[model samples]
Each structure stands twice: as C-alpha cells, then as structure tokens.
Target: MDTHFIAFVLRALAVRLHTNRDFLSWYEHTKPDFILCTNFLGGSVIASIAKRANLKVPIFVYAADVFNNPKAGYCSKIDRLFIPTELGVKNLLSQGYTKEQVRLSPFPLQPSIQQMEKLSKSEARKLLGLEDCFTLLLNLGGEGIGSTALVKQLIKNKLAWQVVVVGNLSEASKQRFHALAKQLPGMSMHTPGFVSNIGHFMLACDVQAGKAGANALMESLSLGRPFLINELLHAARNTQTFFLEYQVGWVIRQPKQQMITLKAFAEDKTRQQRIEYNLKALPLQFDSDQFVNLLLNEVKSLAD
Candidate 1:
C-alpha cells in the first residue's frame, strides 16, 4: 500500500483522545503504527497520549529550528529525533540528548521549491515582469520581519538595480512597499504581496537580501543567487557557516556593508563565478524521489 500522511487538528485531537477508551477507539479506526510530527507541540502531545494509553507506537519528530529550542520537552518521549545539520546534532547532544535517538536529516523544503523546474535568470525575470536591470530580491520571509526601513534604504540607495520587495503575508507591508514602488521610479522597484512562487523569484534575482533563515538560505543556494542574509539572526548561524565555509554567500548586517559587498561582487566576476561553480557542485541531494524513498525507509524501519 502507498504510504500517506494524515493531519490531526490539535484542538479536536485533544478532545477525541481525552480518555483511554477514546484513544483506543481513534487508534482502532485509524490503525496507525506510529506518528511523525514536524514540530514540538504536536509530537509532545501525541507522545503523551500514546504513553498514557499504553500504546507502543513509535513517535518520530523533525525539529524545524536549527538551534534546539528547550521547549521541545517531548524529545524524551520520541523514538527518533531528526535534526537537519551536524551543527544541530552538536546542539542537541550538548543538551544531553542520546546519540541513538537523533538522526541527521535534510531541512524540509516546501514541495513547490523541491519540484520547481530550473529556469535561467533572464527567463525567470521575464516571467515575473522585471526588466533587464540587475535584479535584487528583498524578502523578509512569511511573517514579514524587518520589512519597512530596510526596503526604504535599498530603494533610496540602490538606484542602479531593480529591487522586488515582497510584503510576504502582510497587507500593510504590501501597501507600504507598493507606495514606494510608485514613488521610486529611479530604481526599478516591484512590490508583490505574499508570492507563492518565491522559489522562482529567488531564481530570477541576481542577489537576495533577507533574514538568515532556512527557507531563504536554501532557496538562494538552490538557485545560485548571492545571498545577503542578515547577520543579526543568530538562529541561522549553522547554514551561514556552511555557506561561508563553502564560499557561496555572505552575512551583511548594515546597508553600508550591502553596498560594499555588491560593489565588490560587481567588480569581481571571477569571485562570483567561483561561488556559482561551488554552489552547483555542492551535493544537494534534493531530489523528490530520493526524499520520498528516505521517508519510506524510515517508516518501514519503525514498522519492523
């Protein structure tokens, strides 16, 4: 039988499994051999229910954060704890999690990013209605962190390049940038709101200026863009180190630093080319088939 994933609404799930009899009824109806949760709350709660009901089902959890957050008290109850990077493993180990319980796994990417067809930068820009100007992608991620002033600074100073600043799930943010796009004709500017095709945008842009985040970091690498991640977000250090060590990207904390880096990048084609070559050469192993097989193997092992 083909393996499929199921979602449980936490509120309804809690009420349904409030008693052992209720849990048994639910389990019998579903016949699940185990559970795998993406975050701490769901995993912790599920583990508790299984234990209380004397259910021997394995609980697997993929902690999304690069640094181990102490709130994930459910690690003790989990049969397997998957961490994304070696740095993550070190963090978890330092917190006294047993080596046997932890497994190194790839950072989970959205299906859209994983399945996106490779497109040339020009083709991507054309699709997005951008002109031939040097394209810069300004994303503050889904929650719209550090959106306002950073964008204004870029628009004011970056007169040479075309910048696409996305509001990313914030209407107020979208309106704010959209207003700037009208006013800043000197620098070709586009303000889009909460784009679903962000991976494509990453592909289209020559450079990325955003938070040092997992999705942004990975998407930039996946597309070979020069990532200009914020140095202040300490949670992203693991990926930052990997990129810096591999000579793929940089962390910039200030607007002045952004200009200095971009100026250097513009003048240094050899350096940029080298970084691109290194990026393409990295063993990403991001194929959908391979990831599906990996998940299936993990599930099968638990079943056995």
Candidate 2:
C-alpha cells in the first residue's frame, strides 16, 4: 500500500534495485526523496545504510513496540520515530526523544470493516470437524512447542474436553500429537497445522491458550475469544501488561500453573462465567486505520 500510494503521488517514478555491493553508488546516483524503515529492521541498520549512502534524504523509523531503553546511539540518527500507542510515545519521552521527532502510528489490518464478519460457534465447529463439546484452542505461535505433552496430559486426566492444536509443527512433534490423538478415543484431539483459517478456529472454541504476541492478542479480541496467556519470560512481562489492562485474558505464572488454571476453569462453572463476563467487556475495536493514516501523512510530509 505504501509503495502504491507513493507511486500515485509521484508522476514518472522509476523504481530500482540496489545490491549490497552497489548500494552507495546507486544512492548517490538516484538521490531518492526519502528513506522509510520498519521497526523490525531496527534503527542501527537503517542509520548505517543512510550514512554510508551519504544522502540527505530524511530517515523515518517506525517502532511497533514500547521503547523501554532508548539511548542516543539509537535515537540520534532517526529524523522521526513512528510509534503504535500513547504508551509507546511516553516510553520514548522517558528515553529522551523530543516530542517533535515522535509520531503516533498504529498497525493496520489488510481486511477492512466490511470483512470483519464472524461465524456462529456451531457453524464454525462443523466446518472444522470439531466435536460439539467444550473445546480449547492451544496455539504456540509459529513453533509448536509443548503441545504434544500438554494434550497427552489433558487426555490422560480424562477431562471432558476437546483439544485443538494450531500452527506449524515439526515432523517429530506432528507424530507425537497424532499418536496422542489416536490414544484418546472419545476425546477428540485435532492438529491442523499451519492453517490460514485461524479466525474460524478461534471463533469455534470457547477459550484460547497461547503466547502473548500483540497480533495474537488483537486477533483474539477482534474475534471476542477469551484467551489464556501462557507464562512468559521475565523480559516480556511488560508486553503482557497490555492484555491484562484490557481484561481480555489471564496470565499463567508457570507451566504447572497453566495446567492448574485450565483444570480449575473446566471444573468451576462460576469461575468460567466470571471470565466470560470479563472477555465480553473487553474493547473489540482497535485503532489500526488511524495508525496507517498517520504513517501515510508522515511519509508524505517527509517527502514534501
């Protein structure tokens, strides 16, 4: 979208590719209007590339997460830093970045409001071949870890529930989960690997158990699925706080604690009801469109 929008603004724009060997030479020859870098690439690499190019083009950095430790080495080279939330902006200020250099930019989804349709729970379950019972969707991100063992233990305990594991799994992990699925006769366990229809699966289940990635959290909220955040490393506690503040999910303190919580949720109907109430109260709407617009405007301002 950014590339297409830029093309729309500029007439007779010629795009070129520059290899590492000829990057400086190409930059000197072309002298492009502006340089925009996404946060995933980090500020250091962008700064180095711009300095080596020896071009006066304005450099803009878009940070998707909170900048807890912002130092001069990272901030000095960036002309402007685009952040996702007001919390991010405050974090930047604490790191000594001037207000002028910081801009609020949120993440955007490809699908618009019209595409935000949801399937009924029964319809979604039927489509996915899930049994008509209490189901839990366990998503361990791209790397499917702790799934095989977790499902096996859940089944061994003879819990009246369905376990569905989603995401990419290694060959060994796949075999293990498959064996467990076969062992548990009445307990229907399914492992549909690397599926694009995540929304369907999310809507089919009563609750979600997974890591606290921002994208995953937002998707769960958008689908109105109550999530159980797995225990994370100490460094990632701040990131987990975002979900806690919104009351969309509960955080597990450890692997054993996760199992205890799940067991309790399954047994205690009152606790489950309270959790469902909190999940319904969470805000479904996100400011992704506003973020995209701010980013586009900032890019245009820099280009002008």
Candidate 3:
C-alpha cells in the first residue's frame, strides 16, 4: 500500500511529495535529497521527467518481476534495482546488470500470517470441510488448467480420494466439475473458488498441483505440502531448482503425464506417505526480515 510505503519512508527519513501546480512551487522552494518511484510509470518516463526537471536525485526502481524478463527493458534508466531473490539477481546479471547495481531482497508477505503458527492437518481440513482420509488440492495459480480433466479421469479410475480445486474457475467449469463429482461417489470434488484462507486449504490437503508462482510455492513449502508443478511458465526452471534443492516435490512437463502418475500415486498409500515424509523433511528457506532489511538498506544507499 502507498500508506505503508509512506510510513516506512517517514520512519527511515524525511519524505515529501509535490504534484500538479504545487510541483513548480515546491521545486522553487526546496530541493529533494532523493526521488523514489514505485514503478508507478515506465522507467523511461521517470527518467525523462527527472531530466526535464534538471534533478540530480538518484532514482531507484523497485522491481518485482523485471529481473525475470530483463528484455522487457524497464531497468535501463534506474540508478539501482531491488529484486526479491538471489535467482532474480542472477537473472539480472545474465541480462548485463553489474553486481553493484542489483540488490537482493525478499518479497513481502501480508503481516497477518507471515509468523503465524501453522494448524494441524485434521484441524485445518475440518474447518474447510475437507476429508482427512485422502485428498489432493490443486492450485493452478489464477487460471485453473488441466485440473478438471485430471480430476474427472482420477474419479473414473475409482480412486478412493477426493480432489479439491482451490483457484479461480469459471461457472461452466465449476458445473462440469460438480457433475463429475456426482458421478464419483467415493471421490468428492470441491471447487471453492478463491478463498482468502488458502493457507488452511494448503495445510488440509496432501498435495498441490499448479504452475510455480512464487507465492503459492512458498506457501506450500511452508506448510510441508508436496506440490506437482506445471513446467510451462518462465519461473518453472527456478521452481524446479528450489524443489530439487529442498527435496520438496515433483515437477511434470505435461499435465496428462502428471495425471497418469497421480492416479497411480493416489492408489498407492505407501508412495503417498513417502512423498509426504520427504515434503516434511524439507527446511524452510524464506526469510522476511532479511528481505525487508536488504531493501531498506538499498533504498537508503541510493538516497545517500
């Protein structure tokens, strides 16, 4: 939020803003120590404005995704860049940015649940109306793809497990899933679209199925849930590396192949147990305090 950023700035140092007619008046009356923009406009636009104003204040561009695809050309005009992960730093370096210009930071999570203790599986499942027996939760980011067909096939095979889809789904897609849910009596299917308490859902279920968005993947790992990631996204390589490093979960290129293996795994209780054990053994690697401190320090350095 703007207010949150403003509060952070005020705590660190003096902050001021001038706009519209007041811009000229403020520029004439006072000189700024630094200028910071939260990527509100394009980097080139910010650079041009600074040039036209004859301001020498350093401009720091806080980028969340710029490093992921540096060819997007948003980092050229900024004095420095702040990225969320070491992976991001590597990406920037590969794109020709010097090491000194890039700072590693952590992505900020909502304060409400960052440090909150995780709930027990049974307690979490009970709250979400999920069965504690055998269930797989698929979180395909915002766009739920290949999961409906996979769930239907799993039910057709008479697997004694429930499938819960926990992302955005169209009404038609939901209706189709509901119909399949009726056909498969032993396999109850629930598509509760977009719940804020997704952490509880992640904890309640045995597995996650989706593309590797950093937010969802981190949450799944934090809750010790094995994930089945789609390997089509640009972040797939990074996700694969993380999973391999941590021994967290499996990755599949084709959804059809994943479904075939999932069907087999669903029927094999021993295999599922083994997978869960491995997931539990994986250590937590995300550190928010380090992330925030790094970002603040970088911003301060740019100001200096």
Candidate 4:
C-alpha cells in the first residue's frame, strides 16, 4: 500500500474509533454547552459531531503554534479561536482570519507554577543546595534534546559556573556530567532529572539556557530571570521574538558561540541590571484564576 494511503486509512480508523457508540453516549451524557479544542483537525471532528446532534454548543480552539493555518472549512465550524500572543494573532490575520475570530489570551500555565511561592535568590539557592555564585540552568524540556551538546561546549570552554541540568536526562548524560564535575573541581554541575519544584530551580539560576518553549519563557519572566536560548524550535520562533522585543533574554545564534555569548553576558552587569529592570517594569505575575475567569466569561456570554 502507498504510504499516504495507509496514513489516511489509519487516520480514518482513529476518527471512527473516537466517535464510536460508547464515546458518543458518554459525550451526550455530559451535555456540554461549550467546547474548547486544542487540536485543529480534532476540533473539526468534534464540531461535526456537535452539529449532527443539533447541539448549539460554541466551539473554541486554543492554538499555541506561531503559524496556524487550519483549512478554511474547518475554521468555519469554529466560533472563536484563542491565541497566546499578539504575534500569533498577526500570524492568523495574515492567513486571512478575521480579527473578531482571534482573541489574545494568557498562555495556559502549569498549576504548580501558578501556586508556587516567590523565593528570593538566596532562599532558592539554599533550598536547592546551590552555591552563591554565577549560576546557569540548562533545561531543554523533558526529552533533554540538544542538552548534552551544550553541556559539552560549556565544559570544553571551562567557564567556571554553577550548572544545573534538569529534565529527563539519559543515564549517559548524567554520567558525563558527573565525570566532568569530578574532573573539574572548580566547575559545579548537578543533574536532577524531572524536578517537581522546577520554579525554585529557575529562581536559583541567573540565566535559563534552553529551548524557547512558551512555558519556560513565561516561568522565567515571572521569576525575573533572563532566558538564554541555545536551541530554537520552529514552533517557538515567535516566543524568541517575544523575548527579544521585551529585551528580557539573549539568544545564542550559533552552537559554537555559546561560550563566548555566556562569557559576555556574565561580564555585562549593566545588561543584567537592564533586563531585571525591564522585567520589574512588566506585569508578569497574575492570579491563577485569570485564565479560568476568561473561559467562564466567554462561556457565560454564549449562554446569555
């Protein structure tokens, strides 16, 4: 069978499975008045099901991608689309979506991050058993992609700083970090994979170096720390722009230039203070219920 045909068949099977009798029965029993879908194609299927049932449910989509281009037919079924930033809104507008169709909302945040108590740098360092020195946090999300290479560069350059590596690190990466810590007494390194108190870790570090993920960027902003981007995923390009526009972070354009950039950033106290000043000037911390309230108001308006 042709690869595309096989993929089409599997997708059809999955959709059919999703709208099976049992699933339909459960969905009907729930009697949902409003629907919010995060997946583009999935939202289309859900909208069709609601239409078939003659339910007057309002369908909304929360898209995180910087460039979102759902088929016009699929978008027609959606009542409203929510995006996290103005850049996302611009992307949708350029794709021919009406301004009324796209509304900007705060990026959804983790519950732990929202409820986390603010910690002073000294307090956070004490809690994490980190030394009072220049600290760098290398986090590239749970998969730990592109992390080992950055760590290798940092080690090769021998920039003596407290380095903490987080996320789902492979055993090989852990061993490498351990070996380096032993070999170089001046360089401090700790790899605690998948920490629950990641907000604290972010607090304890001077700069966050990793992928330009929305969640990480938001957390770094709330914590008033500059994010150093080493890897730029295509999906997070807009997030990188956001950081640059706000002057709250630095970007390492080339992998080999990581050390030189870090060295410069470390030496530039004026730049550090400027970023901190900008962070303080911006409104970052919000009550956890803000997003929840936004949803409730939207749903209530539909009901009215």
lDDT of 1 by residue, 1-304 (tens): 1111112234235435645466667887897766777766667666767766678778777766644533434335567777666767777677566887787776666789888887888888888888866777887777775645555665666555777876454666666666776656666767785788988888888788888766677667767887877654644556666666677777777776676777677568897788889889865544445545556777778778
Candidate 3, RMSD to the unseen true structure: 8.0
RMSD values for the candidates in order, in angstroms, are 6.6, 8.1, 8.0, 4.1
Global lDDT of each candidate: 0.68, 0.64, 0.64, 0.72
Clashes of 1: 0
Total clashes in model 4, counting residue pairs 3 or more apart in sequence or in different chains: 0
Q: Name model 1 segments beyond 4 Å from true.
A: 1-29, 66-74, 155-158, 169-175, 178-185, 231-237
| lDDT for each residue of candidate 2 in 1-304, tens digit (9 for 90 to 100) | 2232333222112112233336566667887666666653345344555655566777777664432322322545567887655666777676667888887665444363215557888988998888878888988777666535456567667664787888787777767776777766777767886788788888888788877655665577667777787745432355556555765567875656666668887788887777767767753335566766676677688667
Ranking by TM-score: 4, 1, 2, 3
**lDDT of candidate 3 over 77-180, digit per residue (tens):** 45676666566678767866688877665555544447755888888888887788777887856776555666756666666577788777778877887888
- What TM-score does candidate 1 get on C-alpha atoms? 0.78
Better of 1 and 3 by TM-score: 1
Worst ten in a row by lDDT for model 3 = 11-20
Local error of candidate 3 at residue 117 (angstroms) = 3.2
Give the poorly placed runs of model 4, Cα more than 4 Å off. 1-25, 65-74, 282-287
Global local distance difference test of model 1: 0.68
lDDT of 3 at 138: 74
The number of clashing residue pairs in each candidate reads 0, 1, 0, 0
Supply candidate 3's per-residue lDDT for 27: 50
Residue pairs of candidate 4 with colliding backbone atoms: none
